[model samples]
Target: MNLDNILYWFNEVFSSLIFIYMLFVILVYSLMLVFAFLQLRKDRNLDKNLEGKVNLNAVYSKPVSIIVPAYNEEIGIISTVQSLLTLEYPQYEIVIVNDGSKDSTLQTVIDVFQMEPVFRTVQNQLPSAEIRGIYQSKLHYNIVLVDKENGGKADALNAGINVSRFPYFCSIDGDSILSTKSLLQVMKPIVSSNGKVIAAGGSVRIANGSEIEYGSVLKSVVPNNPIVVMQIIEYLRAFYMGRIGLSRFNLLLIISGAFSVFSKEYTIKVGGYNKNTIGEDMELVVRLHNYLLKNKIKKSIEFIPDPVCWTEAPDNLKDLKTQRRRWHQGLLSSLMLNRGMLLNPKYKQIGLISVPYFVFIELIGPIVELLGYIYVILSFVIGNIYLESALTLFVLFLIYSTVISMFSILLEAWSMGTYPRIRDSVKLLLYSLSEVFWFRPLMVVFRLQGFWYFIRGKNDWGSLTRSGLQKKTNDTL
Candidate 1:
């Protein structure tokens, strides 16, 4: 074939394949949206307020140990603990695992809570760094601190698990602020299941422009920053569209470390969190599944929708890029470590459905979409390609990126009143239009960078320079 004809044929074949793949992905995401809609619709009329005296103290039921692994979290550590203290769950103890903070994180919490030395012996069931000392708050009997050597977040969690006295332990991010009833809400499934459910995760909301007091989100307002607003929309879509749907069929592989409840027994049995992987939360979850299916355990992990774990989204592009890249890297690492389960009948739905979905849609989907974008650009500039093909792919990108996000905003409105104001919701809807053109492409590039980093064996848990949730938190406290 002539050079011109060769280029034409190549463009035709590539564009056609991309078009079909985009259609398939859209169909899949559409199904997830429907599943999410049904799930939310089913619980729409239920009296959530009357969840019935959720916090009844440690003696009444399965008391929980909330583990907050802090690494240089001086800015937000105090607020995080303060928020936990206000939790409606009455029977929970707060364990702040200070993972050798280089800053004043250890001293701040100690001085703030007037924590004194306490010689509480732990079984040390999990392998972790040596603990320097354990301290308990004089103000609150339930609050404890573990000062340990620097061993990353997973190791810190492992240390927390070893020291935790309860059957159920919650892993919460030190920089996050939990709603008063969030802990109770997240634990509802586990409590209701009576040991059938092993782990449960709550929805994480962005707290960028929200009103806050004493580590509690007093009011939920959408941030004015466009980037932060886009992240808010992304969170809405990811949790409502992806998580709710995946959890319905017991195919959930990831529960955010920001706020997730796990059975200490099951976690220990599966070898706790993998300290070596950046995606420790995901790796542990996949291992939990692998262990359960391989050993014929009947327990399941879940993602709960109502509980709100407010977290700070990276406001600027630089921090946001780092966060996204690291996230994608973690996702890839988890999938690779558990590659044996992929399409294997032994692991059942997790291997067959969840693994494939994450592999095809979550990981490889970005690269494919990136190619589609490139083709669309070249097709527009360089002649000989069909105009209709370019238009079709562009429309598909719009539907995939922008339309679903708008729907997620609608879902947020219908179910949870996180952003109740009409104007903020309208603003988010407006910004989502630009996602296909700008935001999504940027994410694809960043995520592609993550793939490169993963190949290079980059294991650093990159830090985000935080602008604390509440500027005057320490001074006020």
Candidate 2:
């Protein structure tokens, strides 16, 4: 064949491959959506029935240790602690780990909670950075503070784990606020399952424009910023469609670090969190799965959609880009490190389905989608291409992106019943429709950069600025 004919054939084949990939993605996404919808419906009904029957003050409820790891979270630590103090769970203690912040993070906690330094021995099951001291709150007996040398989030969590007194320890971000019933709801599955559920994750909602009262979100408002709005939609789609479906099959690999309850014994046995990777949350969950499968333990990691943890989302483009890139990098790192589990029958569903989905659909999805975009442009420029078929595929992709996003938003509205204002729901729907045109492409570029950074051996956490949760009252918890 001549050069022109070969080039033409290459374009056609590439375009055909892209079309097939899009079709597969759409099919998988539709399946996930169906699974998610059924799960959400079931959970909603279960929650409704349990609300009247289940007693919050039941004697059998297990105590949890809430761990807040702070690096430079001076601005939001106090409010976060306040939110923790108000949890409706029967029993829990707050342990805030100060990871040697250059800012006055430790001092702020000490002053606010009237912490007194005390010499106490820790189990130190997990290896971590050096500990400076441990403190107990003079005002609140249940609260404890750990002063530790500079370590990343994972190290700080491990340090917290050493000091935690409860069997289950929950990791909460310093900039996050949990609803009053969040802990109770998240722990419900574990309690009901009789230790069959090893870990449970709660839904994380963006708190950019929401009105907060004493560290509790009083109203859930969709932020006016285009980026924040896009992220709000993204979170709904991920948690509702992606996580819920994955968790149903016992194939969930990631439970958000922002608010997740984990069994302390299992966490320590699995070597706590991996300090080396930025995606410690995901890495730890995957490790837990690996450990359970190896030992033939019949425990599960669950995602509880009703327990909401409000978190601050990056409003500016720079901060948002940094966050997305770092997240993608962490995801890539976790998958690479656990490559042994991929297609390994010993791990069952996680190896056969979850890992492959993450590798092909989650990890390389951005590259493929980006290539699809490039192919469309090239086909247009090169004229004698299959124009009609190309346009049809493009339309399918557009519908797959925007329509699925809209459905996710609607699912959130139907299931969670948050964003009560009809106007807010409409706004989210409109923003989700625009995702295919602008926000998705931008995220695609950011994720691609994250892959590049990983390949180039660049390790940067990037900048994350917090505006602090809005407080309606200055009341102390």
Candidate 3:
């Protein structure tokens, strides 16, 4: 065959595949719209129920042991611990695992809370480094600190989990601040459910440039930087729209590591967090479900949309890229680790539905879509295909992006009403629409790099420099 003929044939095949992929993208967006609508309805109902029902006195709840895995978190450790002490829950203890910080993390806690040595048993251990000493807060009866050798976040969590004595435990990041009623919100499902509720995850918001008073977010204010501001919108859309729908179907793949509450027994049963994968939060949840399936035990992993936890976002481009790259790597790790469950009939929706959906859309969708876009642009440049076809595809992409962003905002406004100001909501809407053209492609590049890094077998836990939550007068509000 002639070279021209070969190129023509190849182009034709590629164009067909691109068209099919575009169609698939359109279908996913359309389904997201439907899911968004359903979620908005639920959000409306939840809002009505949640408005007057945030009262923590509603019921007697089980005591919770909050586990915060801290590694060199000197900037915010004291404040984060202070905030936990103020939570509205009646019975709870705070356990902070200082994972061999080279900073004054241990000393600061010791000074602030008048720490004293305490003895405790690490009941179950999968794998972790040595413990230096366990300290209890002289000021707060419920607070305790474990000084441990350097390990990864998963290892730190395992240490905390092993030390916790409560029936339920919440694994939280050092930089995260939980809502006063978040535990109550997550615990409700566990209390009412017929069987054990193994895990429950709550929504997380960006805390950049917000007033933080003693570890709790005082108000919702958009960050000054465009990147951070856009992240705020992204979190809203993700938690409100994506997680809510998945949670409804009992097929949520990840519980946010920022604020995920788990039953102590089930977590221990699954060997705690898998220290191997960067996506420890998700891998543990999937392992729990797999264990349940294996043992023929009925369980649930619930997601509570009303319970909000505020966390800091990357302010600069470098940090943002690193965070996104790590996230992509974690997603890849999680999917690869659970490959056995993909389309396996026994696990039902989790195996046949959620796992495959994540594998295609979330994990690998960016690579496929990016290549498709490149092909369309090249075809236009070569003047081979009609310009109208490329233009139509571009329009379709815009429509998909705008629709999902708009739907997510609508769902949030109707459901949780977190972004109360019209201006803030409008800004989020605009950012979501703009994400497709800007943030998404950058994400694609970063995620690709992540995949490459993982393939290259680079497994170092990179240091994340903290600027601390944006300081303002309302820092303690």
All candidates' TM-scores?
Answer: 0.97, 0.96, 0.93
Residue lDDT tens for model 2, 1-477: 999899878877887888888888888888999999999888677655467247576514589999999988988898899888888777889999999999999999999999999877799799989999999999999899999999899999999999998999999999999988888888878887889999999999988888887777887888678888899889998999999989999989999999999999999899999988889999999999999999999999999898899998998889988999999999999999999999999899999999999998999999998987777766677666557656866787787789999999999999887799988999998887778778888999999988989999887877698778855422211
Per-residue lDDT tens digits for candidate 3, residues 1-477, read 999988878876776776777688668656755775776676556553464365445425567889999988988887778778777787888999999998998898889999999887777555778889999988898999999998889999999888888888988899888777787777777766733677899999888777777677777776557888778767766787678778877888898999989888888888888888888998998888888877778887878887888887888888888888888888888888888999998887788888988887888877886886786577689774546566766776676566766777777787677757787777777777787788867877878877987898776557677877525534211
Model 1 misplaced stretches (Cα beyond 4 Å): 54-59, 472-477
Instruction: Tell how far residue 222 is off in model 3, in angstroms.
Output: 1.4
Query: Whose TM-score is higher: candidate 1's or candidate 3's?
Result: 1
Worst 10 residues of 1 by lDDT: 468-477
Choose the strongest candidate by TM-score: 1
Deviation in Å, model 1, residue 403 alpha carbon? 0.4
Better of 1 and 2 by lDDT: 1
Superior candidate under TM-score, 1 versus 2: 1
The root-mean-square deviation over C-alpha atoms between each candidate and the true structure, in angstroms, is 2.5, 2.8, 2.6
Clashes of each: 0, 0, 5
Model 2 weakest lDDT span, ten residues long: 468-477
